[model samples]
Target: MRLWVCIALLSTVLCASAERPRIVQGMIRAGQFVRDAAGGTRDMYRAYKDMREANYRGADKYFHARGNYDAARRGPGGAWAARVISDARENWQSRVSGRGAEDTRADQEANRWGRSGGDPNRYRPRGLPSKYYTRDDLHLLWLCRSAVAWPGTMRLWVCIALLSTVLCASAERPRIVQGMIRAGQFVRDAAGGTRDMYRAYKDMREANYRGADKYFHARGNYDAARRGPGGAWAARVISDARENWQSRVSGRGAEDTRADQEANRWGRSGGDPNRYRPRGLPSKY
Candidate 1:
């Protein structure tokens, strides 16, 4: 009898928790949640989100290029949404690494971030544009998450922040951005992926080819896409962009340099003007 009663109580408790819905869309109204503790009210997530959005709005303008970036990329924020989920996962691991996947505090934080569109269902309960966040937005989420979660503690989070900085710096290297641009160019040229032509013939067949010819993926898929449909145009564009990109990417400039280029910035030949040396002539020795 006691066991049955206990099970019933547990189910009721879980159902109650599940019932408390969260819909933090635009502005935050901190009155109700800040008060009703038993109602599962907690403004911490809202606080974290607000702080994160403020930072991402600015970062989205600078770090992410317009007209190309997907709204919901993947990983935490996307494949590169490291700034938001890494530290929390790490810190959660640091605090409770050995525990099972069902660990309490870890599950709590996971639920919080997940509700904010962090994982498999990142698009399901979507609130804002995933492209809305740049690399810096990830940092903002990490920082804000840490702040609201820990409030006054700086020691543990400081180390976390530093680690995040290092990882982000490595991942968001200028090279990555440049590389993506080159890849985009490659896709454009090789596939003959003209903006107009793509849109024009897009529905000519009407066999659900909306993004059929569109390409931009990771290594293998991207390369594979380069062989699909308009991949010829993409390849050509990539090839052209690469001609210039290859010069710097290969580090060959440093390996082999001509004397003329270094001397006087190539304004004039080192040969004496009075010597009257021509392109194919020997001057007076």
Candidate 2:
């Protein structure tokens, strides 16, 4: 249920801006550096993992000290020490699915307790229902042409990026014009690739393997864009960004720094206040 709710919110945002369209990637790269900085949107999962490790280490040290001190005593004269150790072990085990052997026994007991209809994959998230997002809903071709122009909605802005390749070729004012063109190409290619990825997600949700394979073209195109005209910079920044954002709602700060450096080298600031945006990238998401 929590997973479904999360997916629903993400899908709704994607769908909601399907018609209005905005250049979310470009805007973020160009102006939202400070915003991404504020919330730690990038590497948030890494931070959480670090916190979890710290908590576990602290608990382990405390419990190990307690058990070692108590378990050292022996004989009937040390019965009180033995009881302390046993109770401490049980309490610690119960707190964390039981510790080692105790936990293994508890699992076996639970398995037997629910043998009639126990689920082995209860931890696995259930796939979305077949009709989750009809073929029409996730299909980028059928989505609104101007859908991705805002600060937050990525769909419509992505759709518009499909048209940027043509203009990028003629954008020569910037001395490092090649970088801008390459960046534009990355935006276009990454967007189209992302749309197909979304479609694949939809297909998988419906158990539509054959349908999912249809996005194979997108995968190939994405590979080419990343490996060819789009180049290494694109791979490190653009594609990685879309991938990170979709999967983790995050971005890479290191890549952002690289982009800023590249843009600065080309006489354009990634954090420029009055960035010249096409109609696609408005002030909001």
Candidate 3:
């Protein structure tokens, strides 16, 4: 009996020793997961801030891709966090803010591309500053390509490329301006504006669209506004005229008219038409 008891005690000790290592390993894994998730969240926030500060109109997709890419690089936990955040953001935009389905899908595509380690540079806008890119070597490549063809002087071109990159990196990032529409462009814009408004009306009538009037209104204005100052002016005139007719003749309530006007102004002022667009709309539009 004494020998049996000693053997039993030794077995128990061995089991405890083996279990302890597994528990320690589990704790370490859990800790790493938490750290990775935190890092991913940070990456998302940083990307958003950078996008806002850069405010380069067409570079939004690039930033979206970059953020997801960075987070996914952290590992499983990071990928999970990024996906969760991105889905949540899109959900809020679609359900609450009335953003378009097409836009959301496009954003998701960019997100997936980044997570899968695909280059975000595909969506990069022309003239977007080199500073906004993660790969600084691209700037050198661009400079080298543009360098006044130094015929046979390969070394000179290489030195110029290197020097240009250094100077560009040190220079403060220039603010990108969507330059003003020139006076000469007004005539062409005016014609385009009228066409856009008419097309919107025609589409609405033909589609017999009922649920998303505000989206149509915003889209028409957005298309018109893209034509420049003349388009903006034409949009305002048409919108005001339509609202007056609806309130006075068509018997639309003041509240409805007001909402319509708000949507019109939103698009006219260069706000995204997707902000008023609903899901399930045909993407061909």
- Top candidate by lDDT: 3
Q: What shift in Å separates residue 226 of candidate 1 from its native position after superposition?
A: 18
Give a tens-digit lDDT track for model 2, residues 52-169: 4445432232222222222221122222333344455456666886367755454333333222222212211233122221111223233335454445657655555433322222
Residue range 1-285, candidate 1, lDDT tens digits: 989856744543333221123322111123222223212211223324433664633232122221012222221123133223334554576567676654434444444443343322222222333433433334444544544545466646644543443333321345554444344334333434343233323332343323221211111123323343445344334434533564678665632223212221211221111121123211111
C-alpha RMSD for every candidate = 27.4, 24.5, 23.7
Where is model 3 more than 4 Å wrong at Cα?
1-20, 135-285
> Order of all candidates by lDDT, from best down to worst?
3, 2, 1
Poorly placed runs, candidate 2 (over 4 Å) = 1-148, 152-174, 208-285
By TM-score, the better pick of 1 and 2 is: 2
What does candidate 1 score on TM? 0.17
lDDT of candidates 1 onward, in order: 0.33, 0.35, 0.70
Model 3 Cα RMSD, 1 decimal:
23.7
Residue-level lDDT of model 3, residues 163-271, one tens digit each, is 4443343122222210111222353466678889888878767766565677778878989997778898888899899999999987879999999999999989876
